[model samples]
Target: MVYKMLVLNIDGTLLQDNGRINKMTREAIEFAQSKDIKVILSTSKNFPAAKRVAKTLKVDNHIVSHQGGYIAKELNKPVYVNKIDEKITSEITTFLESFSCQIKLVHEQFSLGNKVKLPENILAKVVFQRTNRFSYSEQYVDNLSEKLQEGPVSPPKIEAAFDNNANLSDAKKAIEEMYDEVTCIEVGDNKLDIVAAGVSKLNGVKYLCEQHGIKRGEVVAIGAGIDDLPLVQWAGLGVAMGNAPAIVRSAANWNTRTNNDNGVAYMVKEHFRKQYKLEFLKKINVLK
Candidate 1:
């Protein structure tokens, strides 16, 4: 089957440990473009981070960020924004505060509400400090607390990261029980994402398809995290990375090599190249 475009998730799916796009991945994207296949980046990261990746790839297309809470064209032009209403947000915030979970609020603009001061690398460390664990340095704790004090009022998205899986799980359960009005998704073992009801990666993909006049069958969605499950199921060809969790793998139509092993490249080569060749052959026979 031929697909009109490919939708990719960043972080664990596209970038390796060092946060750089691998050479093989770049070549694969170029190969797809050569065949006239559009590549759209769908990520949980904010627009600034996603924009950096898009610039590196040199593709001006749609990006699904905040795990479907936001969709934008290029870096600054927002095509869609799905935010938790203030009532739900306030309730969730109160519930989370009772459990000592620090929250980060992401807004429509690039600005972050509840913006913490620690460097991006030390965010995990800060969480550890809050939990009174040996995991975080004092510097991280100090920075985080300081940032929390200088707050922004309203944000579009909320993220809570914990030091241990048990704590994260407890928080997830607590939120589900206390605030039944919102949707809470576990992104990985250590992080919990709270969003408005009816928001998800699937919604983001559908919105993009509708805006661009592309059909569901024309999309190839790829990812490796739990948050990606909705997208994997929604796309015509749902691909799971070898490194994906068992649940994600089971949800997908096909499993590819791990992202570290250029899994995305392999899929593009196998699917798009064959389609391109068949189309070329058809054109040749028609001309004859």
Candidate 2:
């Protein structure tokens, strides 16, 4: 079947483990776009971070960010925004402070996080990722709750990283039991992204599809994280990176090479190459 859109996850699916997009992957994305396919980047990162990657790849399409809490094509104009209430934002950050984890209140244009003393190496993991310098700003404080109390904030997402799985699990459960309006998504072993309830990467992409008159059955979704499972399973063509967890791979319609090996490039080339061939055959009246 012919696909109209390609949805991608940024971290482990589009970027290699070292946090760079390979040349082959870049060209392959271009190839798909050349076929008039719309490619959308669906990521758990904030808007600015996702925008930076799109700008780097030269993809100007709308992006799904903040774990599907925000969707925008341009910095100033948001197609959609699902933000946590300012009061709830304050309470959530306040509660999260008790846990042994770093907390970040993610807004559309800025992020306010708590200043937690930790080794440089560990800090790098939480802070050093893709960012758009002009459109996004990040500030750390002695206390996030105090910062919020100074001014109410309706952020699109709240992010946290725990020191261990036990803390992660307990925090997730406690948050769920306490708030009916929010949902905590465990993005990794000990990382969580909290957003409004019913907000998900799948629903975000679905909204985009509806806006563009595309159907769920005419989309290709690729991802590697636990947060990616729903979309990966629901897309017309679901692909898992070789680096994806075993469960994700098993759920996918196809599995490509690891991110380090240019998984995206492999899948895109192989899939579209066949489509191109079929088109050529039909043009020559070789196949109906």
Candidate 3:
């Protein structure tokens, strides 16, 4: 079968456990691109975070980031962005403040949050450091809700991380129930990502498909994360990593090896080998 697009989730599907793309995975991606398949990264990470990895992989296709709220060709320019309403964002921010967590708002030019304080939890600090190290613009604020309102721009996504899994689950449930206008996705036991209603990695992939005139059946999605389930389920060929959670794996049509085991390469090589042989045979006039 021919695939017009290959949508990969960044954190767990494309990147290995070492937080870098392995040589085999890189070669597989390059091979897919060489075959004229559009390889896109549909991730929950911010544009800069995703762009860094995309550059390393040499994927020139557009990326879907911020959990599908941001679709951009590059970090500097977005083809489309679904930003949360300012009032709704304020309400969500106010609601999340009740929980003991750090809130981060991802904007086009910069990110601002109260969690930038030095005394925040290790996870919060690690997140901040990673963004800073990548040189993604960032700043601090006293009240994110108020500061967000002060500016004309609304963030594409809001993230909250708690120290305890119970509180995080409760907060995620509460937000999902209370904020009916927004979609909440639990990234892990202690974190939740919020985006506009009806927004998701699947939506992002669908948008790209429409723009390119590619049908749903011509797309392949591979991922291993809580937020990746919908995208994986929606693609024509959905593959889940061995390391993916059971739910994610269950959502996929097939399960591949784990990310650390070069799952992306294994799947890609196997999927494209048939097509490659057919083309080679046709070139030699051995097959119609």
Candidate 4:
């Protein structure tokens, strides 16, 4: 069957170093639109952050954010949202308290609350590390008092970043034990995300498809993280990045070059080249 649209994850799959969109990638997305292929941005980032990237890509399709818990039209007009239950949030807060972990909760966006203020350098490292293992580091904890002093905001989503090799077995085990009520998703090797049960990238994609009359098989999902596994699995065609984890590569139907290498352009060109060729063949047969 012919594909109709493309879905891309931001952080690792679209943006290269320093969260900037490379020139080749930008041109590729524009070319896809020139071919009438709709492009969607599916990311774990909040709507605001995703909107910036979406604007850069000139994409007007549905935006999937919060790992699929929230979907909006044009970043500001939300059509659907799947938030974690309040009780679950309370329980998670209590659970993390024991470990003294500073969690960033995401409601509609990054929830402002008692989160520890991480230095810009540390924040950069956390984004790069993509894990929750850093929560166990003394340095992270040392900044907690300053973070708490800044006050709190209610976040429906909670994220903890820790250094690589931090022992998080206990946290993982605890979360698993409560799996029936909460879902603990690892974003990368070092970051842990706890959202309400049944909220994931797959759920968000499904919601978008239903609202837009797009079928699961008509969409192409591209990603490079553990959180994107479900989306890749659910898409009609799953395209993983060359820099993706081994597991992600194994799961996708095709593996493209790294984002910095213009992977998006390659896939977009391939999709349309095949489509145009097929259309050309069909016209030829009809004329005969």
TM-score of each: 0.79, 0.92, 0.87, 0.80
- The per-candidate count of clashes, in order, stands at 0, 0, 0, 14
Model 1 — which ten-residue stretch has the worst lDDT? Answer: 128-137
lDDT of each: 0.71, 0.87, 0.82, 0.70
- Best-fitting candidate, measured by TM-score? 2
Q: Can you tell me which runs of candidate 4 are displaced by over 4 Å?
A: 74-76, 113-124, 128-156, 164-166, 277-288
Error of 1 at 37 (Å): 1.7
Off by over 4 Å in 1: 100-102, 108-152, 178-181, 277-288
Stretch of 10 with least lDDT, candidate 3: 116-125
Order of models, best lDDT first:
2, 3, 1, 4
- Residues 1-288, candidate 1: write the lDDT tens digits: 567778998877788755678888888888887776778888777666676688788767888877777778754568887687665665665555544455665554433333334335536444221211232112223233344445423444677766567777887887788765568888874778787667777888888788767789878999999999988998999999888999999999989988788888887788787666324645877311
Model 4 Cα lDDT, one tens digit per residue, 62-89: 8888777677865446787667665566
Of the candidates shown, which would achieve the greatest lDDT relative to the real structure? 2
Model 1, position 44: C-alpha lDDT score: 72
Q: Considering summed lDDT, which 10 consecutive residues are worst modelled in model 4?
A: 130-139
